[model samples]
Target: MPLNKQFNKDVCRNLFAKDSRRLFLKRTLNSATITLAVSSGLLLPIQAIAAWNEVAFAATNLQTAIKSVLGTDLSRASDKISIKIPDIIENGAIVPVTVSSTLKEVSTITLFSEKNTAPLVAQFELDKDCIAFISTRIKMSQTSNVIAIVTARGNNYSARKKVKVTIGGCGD
Candidate 1:
C-alpha cells in the first residue's frame, strides 16, 4: 500500500479504538455507580417495586374489577374523557386503544374489557404534571365494550366504546 494510504488507515483505526474505549469506560462507570447506589440503599431494587393490585387484575366481572382497582364501583360518564378504538377489530389479540382526558388533576387511567375473562385490562398512574393520556394494546376475549375510567380530583369519570372482535384474542 502507498505510505499516505497506510497512514490514513492507521489514523482511522486509532480514532475508532479511542471511541470504543471511551464508550466502554462510560458504560462501566455508569454500571458501577448504579451498583454502589443500590447496595448502599440509596436506590431500590427492581424486585422491591410495589403498588401491584392482584385482586383487580384477577377480578372476573366489570364491577368487581373497577371496585378493586379504583376502590369505587360508581363512575359518571364524562364528555371530557375520550376513548379512541376501532369499531371493528379483525383480530382480538392486539386491539389498539387510546384514552385521553381534558380533566385536571388526573391521577389514574384504568382500562377494562367487559367480555374478557378477567375484566381489568390495564391501569396507569399519572403524575400531576403529566398529561391524562394513555395508549396501549389490550387483548379481548370477544366482542365487548372497552371502558376507560379516569380518576381525577377523587372523582371517577368514565367513557366506553363498543368493539366488535371477529377473532377472539384470549383463546376462544
Candidate 2:
C-alpha cells in the first residue's frame, strides 16, 4: 500500500515466501499474456511491410553478371538462389534451367551461361503481382556456369552452378 523504506528486506521476504496455488496460476497467466502481447506486436510490423517487383543488371561474363545484378559473387552452395539443370548435358542447344529465389521482395530473375557468345541468356521483368521465378531453355556452347541473379528490396543477390556440355552447340 505504502512505499517500503526497507526495499531490500521487503522484496526478499516476499520472494522467499511459501508459494500458493493462486500465485502460481497468476504467474502462468501473466507469462501467457506477455507472450501473446509480444507475438502480436511482432507479427503486425512484419505483415505491414510490402514487397518489391523489379530487378535489373548487365554483364560480360556469367560471374560478373551475378555481381552486376546481385552486387556480389555467387556461391555454388549456400546462396539465396537455386539453379535447376542437368549436371551432364549432352545437347548444348536446349539446356533447360530454372531460377527461383527465396529472398524477399524479389523483382526479377535473369540467366547467364558463360559459354554463350552473349553471356546474358535471358532477362525477365516481373509484375508486382508476380513471383521471382522463371525457367527457360538456353544454348550453352560448352561447359559453363549458369548464374541466377535475383533482385530484392533494392539489393541484388545471386547464385551459380556449372554444367558440363559434352558437345559444342556453337559449332566450335
Candidate 3:
C-alpha cells in the first residue's frame, strides 16, 4: 500500500472480482428484495396515482357531466364551496378558476363548463393529507356557467358562476 508502489491487476481481480458464489448471492438478494416489495404492497401500479374517467370528461351537458363524474344526478348547492372566476373574460381560451372548500373531509374537486362541447373541464382527487383547494385555467367555448363540485362525506356540494366571454374558444 505504499504510494510509490504500482497497482497489481491480479491482486485486485482476486479480491474484488464477481466470482460465481458472489454473483449467485447478489442475484438471489436482489430477487428477494423485489419479491418482498411487491408481495408486501410497497410497490404498486400507476393507476394508484391518478385514474382517468373518460365518460365523465366526454359528457356534453351539466346534468350528464354530473351523473358521469359523480355517479349521481343530484348535488346540493353549498355555501361552503367557493368558486372564483372573472365576471367577464375577454378571451375564453384561458379563463382562470379557483375552487376551495371549508367543508370537512373533502376528497375531490371537479370543474365544469356548462356550455362547452364536453362540459367537464378538470377533475382532481385529493388524498387525506391534502387541502381542499384547486386552481387552474380552463378553456371555454363561449359565455357559460362555470361549475365547481366538491365531494365530501359521501355527498356532492357545488357552486357556479357565469363567465361572459367576448372571444370564443374551441375554434370560434
In candidate 2, where is summed lDDT lowest over 10 consecutive residues? 50-59
lDDT of 2 at 8: 73
Evaluated with lDDT, which candidate comes out highest?
1
Which of 1 and 2 is the better model by TM-score? Answer: 1
The C-alpha lDDT values of all candidates are 0.94, 0.73, 0.88
The TM-score leader among the candidates is 1
lDDT of 1 at 52: 80
Residue pairs of candidate 1 with colliding backbone atoms: none
lDDT of 3 at 100: 92
Question: 1-172 in candidate 2: lDDT tens per residue?
Answer: 3466578778776776645656888999998987797787954565567433123233556556556555566434437788999999998988989888777777777777876765776667787777767888888888988877676766666678999998867665
Candidate no. 1 TM-score: 0.74
C-alpha RMSD in Å of predicted model 1 compared with the true structure: 10.7
Residue 5 error for model 3, in Å? 65
Off by over 4 Å in 3: 1-50
Per residue, candidate 1 scores C-alpha lDDT tens digits across 1-172 of 6999999999999999999999999999999999999898877766588668999999998999999899999999999999999999999999999999999999999999998999999999999989999999999989999999999999999999999999999975
Q: Give the TM-score of candidate 2.
A: 0.56
